[model samples]
Target: MQFDNIRGFLFDLDGVITDTAALHAKAWAGICQRLGIPWTDALAEGTKGVSRMDSLEVILKSVNRQDEFTMAQKAQMATEKNDRYQELITHLTASDILPGMKDFITDLKQHNYQLALASASRNAPTVLKYLGLSDVFPKIVDPSNLTKGKPDPEIYQHAAALLNLEPGQCIGVEDAPAGVASIKAAGAIAVGIGDAHDLAQADVVFPGTASLTLTALRGKLEDGVLNA
Candidate 1:
């Protein structure tokens, strides 16, 4: 399906541009260990594309301890997890950027497409700076002071607004189901980067970043080849 009307692009950070999801999983596991909660890869996957506190709530729910923790306690735990994630992300370099991401971004820039980041990570700025991509995205809609997270659509809507474009004029790229849902809810074309089953709600799904090409994307958009 083509989205020839698309004028801008909104991207989710972790799995889309880099591989920081594992770092987040590790930090969350450490927090679970300290809290004496059972953690697994499945549980870690639940946190993808969500805010720190939201992820904490999911973790607490998994262990049936959500009702037991006071708001203050939950906040403290979230802070602890963020601290750990922050430390781990400090080790990230441009080398951590996913294959084909840099070239794709450069191509988009050369084509004069507006680029914005719509990630749930509050540490997005730090990671972008570490990757030397601080200036690539002129606008970033992060979790700081955000009340609603994906699959809420507020982040993507905000990103489109910041780009001075309507949601329908932007293509939102994500690797998480929640993010795909969010973008679709925002009336934007969702280009998902993950397993087909995981991103069935998206307008189109690609196996990975390396397989996506600017020419193909443009053709899809211009040719109106999208699924209804």
Candidate 2:
């Protein structure tokens, strides 16, 4: 099956476009330690595409310490994580673009599909700026504008709206299950490009974007257009 006539494409950052999830994990764990909170990779992965406040809620709950942290403490902890995340990303260059992503993004633009940044990352602007691809996307909807986070479709829906395209006329590329659910729930095609277990909700799955040549993605884009 192919996704044809896709008027726009939404791409997630972090693990999708940057090899920075590990950095985020490191930062998050560091913040947890300062606050005497336990950290687990599963919690971090589970909350992968959520916003700061939402992620904090998940982490606190995961460690069975949600009730112990006051709102003020949570805010402080979230800020610490953001600061750490920013420090880690401040020096990332365009050389850090994910495998085949630069080529894939170039091919999509060559085909004239609209490109947008639709990520749960509140630091999308900083990260994009650091990567030197800030101008690559015409639309950007970070986590701040949405009341609900991924697995709820708010971010994807916002991106499609920003492009003035029907949800069916847009598609989302993501590496997390929550992100895949967000795209599908928003009525757009979802392409999962990462570990299968992490993207089980996606309509189509690939081992990694390295295997996703332009020809392959364009085929899927064509299908979305046809179906739209």
Best by TM-score: 1
Q: What overall lDDT goes with each candidate model? A: 0.89, 0.82
Best by lDDT: 1
- Judge candidate 1 against the unseen true structure and give its global Cα lDDT, from 0 to 1: 0.89
Model 1: residue 151 alpha-carbon error in angstroms? 0.3
Identify the runs in model 2 with alpha carbons over 4 angstroms from their true place. Answer: 220-228
Q: What is the TM-score of each candidate against the true structure?
A: 0.96, 0.92
Question: In model 1, which runs have C-alpha deviations exceeding 4 angstroms?
Answer: 223-228
Count of residue pairs whose backbone atoms collide, per candidate: 9, 12
Alpha carbon lDDT of residue 212, candidate 1? Answer: 72
- The digit string of per-residue lDDT tens for model 1 on 137-190 reads 869985675789899989999999999999999999999999999999999999
